[model samples]
Target: MRCARSLVRIQSLRALTAAAGGTVQPAATRKAPHARSLIAHEPCGQALRSLHTACVLLKNRPVATDYQEKSEREGEAAKSLVTYDDLFERAALEAKTKATFNQVLDVFIKRDIRRRGHVEFIYAALRKMPEFGVERDLEVYNKLLDVFPKEIFVPRNYIQRMFNHYPRQQECGVQVLEQMENYGIMPNVQTKVLLVQIFGEKSHPVRKYQRLLYWFPRFKHANPFPVPHQLPQDPVDLARFSLSRIANDLDARVTVYQLPYTDVCETGEEVTQPYVVGIQSPDQRHLLAKHNPSRPVFVEGPFPLWLRKTCVYYYVLRADPLPPEEKVEEPVDPERCFYYPLQLELDLERDLGDDDSFDVDEVDEGPVFAMCMAGRGDQATLAKWISGLQETNPILGRTATVFRLESGVRELQSAAEPEPEARPGEEEEELQSRGVKQ
Candidate 1:
């Protein structure tokens, strides 16, 4: 009875399998179909396919490190392969604007090329600017000027370099200036100053002076006031004064005039020495006449005929008044006070001769007061003179001040005191207004 029951159960199982339209299979074999059905029904199959596709794509794609290495190799090859001529041709073809041209020139400049060659390349590029459809402007020329190396050399070494680089290097700046003029681009004050600095660096004293004088008028015209609050004076006069000061500092022979004394004529005293030749300012004449009526005032010098021509070249430029303590009484005209300072200009060249030795008594003959103007070259000399005076005459030294011609009387008066400390927050406010972060 048990065997028959078991057999009947097996037949029932087979019948169920047939009804499901499949044959009976092992559990492991059946599991795959079951899982596939579950995945298909739950939308996980689509996700799995997408993941597989992404993996394949990622495996085939270029690696960043490999890409960068390849790019670097290509760049190195390109640098070695391309010539400046090729660059020029390429620029000519595609550099169609001023900015583009500038970019091309910048590239040329950055390349490892000889300085002269670089300059030549720039000139060539500029010549073809119109062909490249680039418009030239003042800024372009200025940029070119800026590209010229402005390496400063010590004065002695500069002389040597100038000797070595003569003609070619010297002509470079001049050529640039000429080119700018040709383009009808007027150089501004900054440009003039730059040129002046360049000339000063490259040339000797005589050449430098000549170049300065040549450009000074133009410089003055462009910049009417080099220092603020100073009135515009005659450019010629300023140039002469500057040159004379330069010559004096160099210990070159400078002619200085002495005011004529009437005692020699009135008392019938023999005139042992002739008066030093100088051009007296109208103010000087007015002062002499008012203060010393008995004094013989000579308009021109009584001098040897040969000395007269050379003496006129050098003149007493101006005199600055000593402090009140030095003068017994204030001048009737305060303006004329500068004309008579109880000082004398001894010709160091005459006294020292070729020996260049100075006598202590000769140097200390009278109180030495140095005249300095702001923005002028004589400040250093003035400082030296002041220091010397401090040792020689303590009283006069205390009264001496740096004569800042650009400063007003009030400014000068205030300059004697210590500068006021800034108020709280004022400094920060000023910096902020100037677009600086404190």
Candidate 2:
């Protein structure tokens, strides 16, 4: 009992000392441990027992911890920031393929800006679309491209474009080419190929046909079948139409190669043979505008050399088309889609100087025109004869003269030179009469 009482008194003294700081004084000042304070922590409920033990350990002393300082330091590191520009540039690179980046940018614009950015956004004065939806939405499509500039793709992008764009370029990806450059994004080869296909003279598909590819892997999945309205009902009628147009060309133009000749041997007597020449004016509008398309008036032959010299040949604009003969060669049906107007057929040599839209037909020769040898020609020579006629008539090459580069240069040079100054004839006469001049 004395030892217990002594131990209690000693612990009380130590607790008071610890409360001041935590170090114990020398052993000489403390007493032995008491049996009551020597008990072990309970194993069954150690957590609860440890709490009690802790309270006992602290009962006579002060409590302290470092958790608050650790947490404060961690929070300062967690506040580190990520810039919107870095995110935006990455988004711009991938933005075209997916609109997610654009959405992010819209969010960033709301926050703050650092320096320079896409020029188009500046021009259009647009901040963003779906102002708050950037973090949630993600759907990229051709129609979604409406948010961007058209100049991006139209003529600048290297993407292989469709030929149909000639009619509707706005939707054809022309806008993409322009946008790529305008946004300062570099386009790939595919983008450039597309621009060429849409804006170049021949479409990429047409050129690509030689390799037997109708579609590209990029757009091969797109359905290319003709729309209902564009399909033709009769391919043979289409073929027949080619025959008449071909004949019209043969009669109006001159060619070097014998045009394919069609012949009917029925009646054996040969019914259509007349060697006459024409006197018609050529259409100046047929020539390209880049050239001096307005040509001087010319008269077509049989300006009867004899008739022209004697001022007896009648000059008219275009001979009336003749009846389709069985001897005309037919044209291929598939080539019709590529057909463009024949600008070479407008011949100044054959064109009337005066507009003869008012010419009244006086001859009853059933639409007067120059015709030569319609019946019973040698079959072997038919091709050669027809070929020669192609260049001479308005039906084929039509133009009396082919536009030559040298001829154009000469014409331009002559125009560039100043006209000769008019001589002062009256002044010379007056000077001679004056006699005061030595």
Candidate 3:
């Protein structure tokens, strides 16, 4: 009975191996019958099961030689697909004209991983110039300039690293210029402007001055606008006369005082008004009189108007805001809340003082003096005053520096808003209108 069971198990094992696409020996081919009979006498069932398990494990295992052969075939196919001939054929087929050829080359250069950063691709295109029949022009150079990376990224200290890399970028631009020179290509104003933009900040002051001197003469010859004899100096003052009536409306007089620099007028003296008749100068009284004939003039001199040594003192009565609806139990001090002390220093040379007069309008034709504001107060209030001064007196806006006094003097930041970007079609419309007018 045991022998019959062992023979059946051997038959079942052979059937499984054959079904699994493995070679199976016939029963008649079994040479080791004695060994099988020994197994049948012992635990033949467990032995057959163990044999079957070993066969399954061997069948599922991958062959190393077959895998390696498949990989080699795939690699060869990829290499054939990406060869230089294949790439060049595709690019040439896509490009018919010079412009289109350049576009194709640009795409190829940008997309090619091996040739992205290097200029060898450019040289390669130049070699193919005969086939494309396209002569390299300034546009081609500009396109090449566009290919050079303008920015580089660093994982740490990105902003600083970018700034440090700027000189290297400028060097690349210089190399482009040298290449252009070798090709006997003369750069247009636009190309020079591009180089100037890249290398200008790093250039020496003397070179910058020389460039300006060279260009100024040519620019002057073709200039259509009016050119002034001299430009304005710094620390210009702009004052606006208040139209509102004071306590003694009828008796309120515009008194022009040529007081000494040391005199500190009291706030209660009613002299701390916003409006002033005119600036009093000992030497330039006649000039002031000639310009503003109808306005009252006062001559108060001994004020040193020398270079870097002159000082102008202004005492302005702070405008009070309307009281809020909710009444406070305690009265707030006007000196603490409203009035803030301010000092200003003149920032112009004696010679440039005449330019300041050009900035003032005909109505406010007072002497232009560039002055820096020096005092502690609300920045908002200071900004308001500065804007008013700028609107009423244009000279101060252009030339004067208003400094904030808090522990030390610092220049007040201008509150001018940035201009908005024009819409897409607006610029085209403007150009069209301008052309029609011309």
Candidate 4:
């Protein structure tokens, strides 16, 4: 064994610098390895006989120690095990792979997270995956609770699943809600509604929380906060973690404008509703302006239900919550006012057929008053705008009421504005080229 080891070392050294020829020369004049040296050499005459035996071994039986070019070629993969579409498809279908899915969800969102139809597709893909993911049991429960909405994929039992896995989810009643603190997902009143219900509390919205003489029997007795008749004019922007799931739950609407004034301009990072630049994400802007079919401006009954591509929803809240079918305002019968009879034809005009030319002949037109029309979805708002105008002077009141039709610049577009118009000959070509979609 000693001789075999020494012979192997010597052969290795020879292979290292084989061009140096058959001389047993020292490499770089280094000291001979005194601790270990080649023990014995075979007689030179028998070298030829030993070579034939070694060649046979090399040809017939390959050894692990032997480096064959064929083996390197054979063991490599024909192709990669995973692909981009495979990753995307898996992410769409698997819940347990969310950690892995996160690695690729960005791509899907960028490409396909558009209109409600696209959103529905994305959700379907995500739902098809396993509900449970690869995480510690507690972490899995926390993720299910904190990251997801109320049982979107399965019927309402996500909380139940958490309770089943970690009974502490039953005891504490929220693994996700608890983890939310670390991520700063502050619970809103709406979130609280769900949380309380999931913990087996009742579900009822309070119209006048302060006016309630008795405390809510279902809730834990705590210092109650004031609930406003309407949401604040400006609320926190929670675009990052909000859900389109409960978009219809509250009567909330967001209107954005490009005002020249910088003072009223909001410029801070807030986790809230529709963004205003340095404020929240910009993805919602295009969706509201483009896809929403409702009247673009705020007006009077059904305002707009605007759901943008980015999943930000801004709908109108009618002040009067009356049901849609009823008439908004009843008009007073003129006969009841003061025997208001029609004026005689002779008294109506000095010139019949309104004369050849008409000029301002000292017509006693009343003073003009300004009125604001908002949420113009129904006739009630129009009535309000007309009725809301207070006399500039309190003394004038109803006596000087004169009706005038004041219309805003309802026409005119800037020359630079680009209209989605068809070109001279492109109309037929365009229709013919509306190719089949995937």
Top candidate when judged by TM-score against the true structure: 1
Estimate, for each residue in 122-162, the C-alpha lDDT of model 3 and write its tens digit. 44444454466544376766665555433232113555544
**For model 2, how does the per-residue alpha-carbon lDDT over 191-274 read when each residue is reduced to its tens digit?**
434434434534432233222222234444464431231223342332223222323543343212322344557777543332
Global CA lDDT of candidate 2, please? Answer: 0.34
User: Once model 4 is optimally superposed onto the true structure by TM-score, how far is the C-alpha of residue 129 displaced, in angstroms?
Assistant: 15
Which residues of candidate 3, in runs, are more than 4 Å off? 1-89, 93-97, 105-120, 126-131, 151-175, 193-438
Error of 4 at 398 (Å): 5.5
List, residue by residue over 1-438, the lDDT tens digit for candidate 4.
555654565566546535664243445113134313223243332232223223333444646634666566444321212233455566556544656555454444455433212222333333433343422233333333333233232223556444443233233333333343333233445554444433333212111222122334334235243222223243223221232222322323322221113243266644322222111112322222222222212222222222222323222211222244733566555566466644323545566656757676764332111212132212332333333322222222222222222232333467898878778989767533432111
Per-candidate clashes come to 0, 67, 7, 26
How well does each candidate superpose onto the true structure, as a TM-score? 0.26, 0.17, 0.22, 0.20
Sorting all predicted structures by lDDT, with the top scorer first, yields 1, 3, 2, 4
Q: List the residue pairs that clash in candidate 3.
A: 235-370, 235-371, 236-369, 236-370, 236-371, 237-369, 375-405
Model 1 misplacement above 4 A: 1-85, 113-116, 132-136, 152-166, 189-438
What would you estimate as the lDDT of candidate 4?
0.33
Model 4 alpha-carbon drift over 4 Å, by segment: 1-17, 20-141, 144-373, 377-384, 388-438
Whole-model lDDT values for every prediction: 0.43, 0.34, 0.42, 0.33
